[model samples]
Target: MTKSTKPAAKKPAASKAAPKSSKAVAAPAPAEANKVAKTQIIDMVASATTLSKKQAAEAVSSMLDLIATALKDGKSVGLPGLGTLSVAATAERQGVRPGTSDKITIPAGKKVRFKVASTLKGTL
Candidate 1:
């Protein structure tokens, strides 16, 4: 003779917390097909410069990592003919929930901003 067992029901969270999946972020798609992608840029660099494709890719990756590290350290990065990347401080503010229309206080945070170079801005 065999005994049967049933699964126990799960309990809901006590606090009304945001979902783990809500933090998902997706990069915006390019508006034009003519826009160049990372791979294309790497290939272009390989062809234009003396570096091989692999070397060019590594250099690009390292450069990006350096820039990100700088921003994380609260330092501004200046890219000649491109733009400047800097972090801005934001104060706490009041916001309303979408569905319930309940007022909520948004916490202070930092955001990245870009300033276009005058030469680059003139071209576009």
Candidate 2:
């Protein structure tokens, strides 16, 4: 029989806990919620492509205008890899008034609906 001579591995040390503070907890500011605005998008597009900042801004604005125009004309917009944007009609329904049990009728309305593409959803 052969004798084993390998040394056993050492266990890793535990991490130290963070110290607690007595300061009052404040709600996070809205800007802290990771939001990207249009200007940032324009800049990114310009940098990624060969287009100038002005050209990039114009392109982005034009694309948005086209989408809005199509939606207004009762047409569904489909971007191959992105998704589809369409207007949905919602039926009238009953809703309860806040702070009271009184029932109220909600009028039917049209709302924009986005259906994410399976390809995009799968990537996430």
lDDT winner: 1
lDDT at 122 for candidate 2?
100
Candidate 2 lDDT tens digits, 1-124: 1233222222222222222222223334455558888999999999999999999999999999999999988899999999999999999999999999899999999899999999999999
User: For residues 41-87, what per-residue lDDT tens digits would candidate 1 score against the true structure?
Assistant: 89999999999999999998899899999999999999999999999
Native-to-model Cα distance after best TM-score fit, residue 106 in candidate 2, in Å:
0.5
Residue 42 CA displacement from its true place in model 2, Å: 0.3
How many backbone collisions does model 1 have? 0
The reply for model 2, stretches above 4 Å from the true place, is 1-33
lDDT for position 115 in model 2: 96
What's each prediction's TM-score?
A: 0.72, 0.72
CA lDDT of every candidate: 0.84, 0.83
- The TM-score that candidate 1 achieves is 0.72
Candidate 1 RMSD to the correct structure = 11.3
Assess the local accuracy of residue 3 in candidate 1 as a C-alpha lDDT between 0 and 100. Answer: 30
